[model samples]
Target chain A: MLDIRQTVEKPRMREKISEFRVGDTVKVSLKIKEIIKEERNKKKGSKEKVTEKEKIYPFQGIVIKRKGGGIRETFTVRKESHGIGVERIFPLHSPIISEIHVLKKGNVKRAKLYYLRDGKKR
Target chain B: MIGLIGKKVGMTQIFSEEGKVIPVTVIKAGPCKVVQKKTKAKDGYDAIQLGFGEVKESRASKPCIGHFKKIGLKPMEILEEIRIEDLSKFKECDEIKVDIFSNSKFVNVQGITKGKGFMGVMKRWGFKGMPASHGTHRKHRHPGSIGQHTDPGRVFKGKKMGGKTGNEKITVKKLSVAGIDLEKNILLVKGSVPGSRGSALFIFSDLNVPVNLQTTQLQAENKPVSVEK
Candidate 1:
């Protein structure tokens, strides 16, 4: 049943998806859109000027878990800032992800490094 | 409105023009053939009959096979008649493709919701069951009360109660069409439709008044409308 579904989704799936797995330290660049509205008092008929800007922000962390399959695939990353652990799940084939750079691959036995959720897990 | 018979091919996500992710359900839509055309002067109504999918000769009745053979067409597995106001351009054996909706921004999909047989009031009707701790025994999932004992005693005819859930025709209106594949006859409708994967659905163009399912019920009450693929 999923075979026909795969055919429709295969083309949309990223061809250059980064080859990385759980416990791998990676930096993910995300695309964010910002809308700025400017008002000008030139004329009564003039409308407000609206501008859209695309920004790329980077989130560097260790891959804690990866789940789902096909275009719906997603992975969770854990990073600590100010002694507080932060985790974000990214859809593996999401267009919002501008780039993914694998920094270091850790030799972890488990597929999901959820133990890191406890904070500073050895 | 004109529509095509389509089979649910499951769902997936695709990037929009602005690089935003959009969830869409892929449907293998027609390539349906106009098997017969009904004229008001002849049949008392103006309509067009369409045939979809193909099957072996042995699977179909001999008379059905002859009917298709008479028109120089292969025996189709499913046949549907749609009441149309404009039938001047269409003719018998004319092919209708998914491209009929190339300019359609949205479509209406109708299908049977996944059936969950005979369920309790709590699951089916969202009725708040009895409290667990307040001296309640075995009526935890029971519906609180029926009505007055003698005055208008019997339960209302259309009262919400525990019974069959789903497995009935439902139309989801105004689902945006995310994409269309003319070559593959695939329609990417933004959002989910009723029924499971491989289930048959009627995709009606937004311009049409969604007469497919309702007309089927009004015309043929005993027969199953769309064939399950």
Candidate 2:
């Protein structure tokens, strides 16, 4: 299994990624593309020119679960947005992820913190 | 159609330009050497015999070594014949690489699936077994109600009973080419291909018939003709 994984994922693996474990509060800077529509005057009629603008959206949350291995590894981050809990799963090696900054490391016993979803306000 | 012999490396996910994750199977294809070319006049069809994977001369059989020696190449472990409409583009001893599929969008991968041995009706034939409850004793995974009562007599011959599961030639059609690495001679195809890692696979451009000859013909037609006096 290790031999197969090395051959398949080694070529596409991300070179530099900050090492952060589960139960760590991290800020993930994600690159999002927004399509901006503008009216352009052409030869006969007006046409809409849709252009894409790239922006970085920072999401700060606590890492609840880290699953998979190698290039297919993914981590789930849970955060409270406007008193509502929001969970987002992001591939660790995805090119869309601009940067990952570890804010705080919480010492936890279990690998998956799925109990936090049902427990009372932490 | 032109094709190359490859080995199934493994499966991994890669992000597309749209940032969507696509599951892909990595295939270590070619550097295949054309060992023989069959023409319509000689063999009743046009095809190219390609050889891949180097093997030690001592380890290979005498006939296999002689076949490679005739083409002026090292001993190859696997050999496959690909039927194409035109065989003039390829020549004996010419090396075919992964770049042959650079212009191709989709391909059909043929390989032997993993063997599951003798499986039950529920697993092999996808038969809905008997209910676990309602006093159903030890016949839970049995193939309930095979045929009719006295009219047909015995069970029908062509029944979908479980026997052999896999380990047969399976062709997966129209798998999109996710990416290609020329330097490493690797091809990343979208979705899972047949067989496990290191299994030999025949990767072709089309499933039914070879159409790569059309591209060569179009290139010939587009060539600038010299003006003569």
Per-residue alpha-carbon lDDT of candidate 1 for residues B7-121, written as tens digits (9 for 90 to 100)? 8888888887566789899999989999888898999988998888878988999988988887799999777787786789788889999988988888999988999999999
TM-score of candidate 1 against the unseen true structure: 0.87
User: Can you list each candidate's DockQ?
Assistant: 0.67, 0.48
- Chain A, candidate 1, TM-score of 0.88
- Candidate 1 lDDT, tens digit per residue, A1-122? 57767777888888997799899999999999989998877687667999999999899999999999888888999999888899998888887888999999889999988788776546
- CAPRI band for model 2: acceptable
Clashes (candidate 2): 1
Compared with the true structure, what per-residue lDDT tens digits does model 2 show for residues A1-122?
34644666776677889889889999999999999998888765979999999999999999999999888899999998887889999988888998999999889999999988885855
Q: Which ten contiguous residues of candidate 2 chain B have the minimum total lDDT? A: B207-216
Query: What is candidate 2's CA lDDT for residue A40?
Result: 83
Residues B110-221, candidate 2: write the lDDT tens digits.
Answer: 9999999999999987888989999999999999888998987899889988798899999999999998888778898999999988999999886334545555456558
The residue pairs that clash in candidate 2, if any, are B1-B210
TM-score list, all predictions? 0.87, 0.84
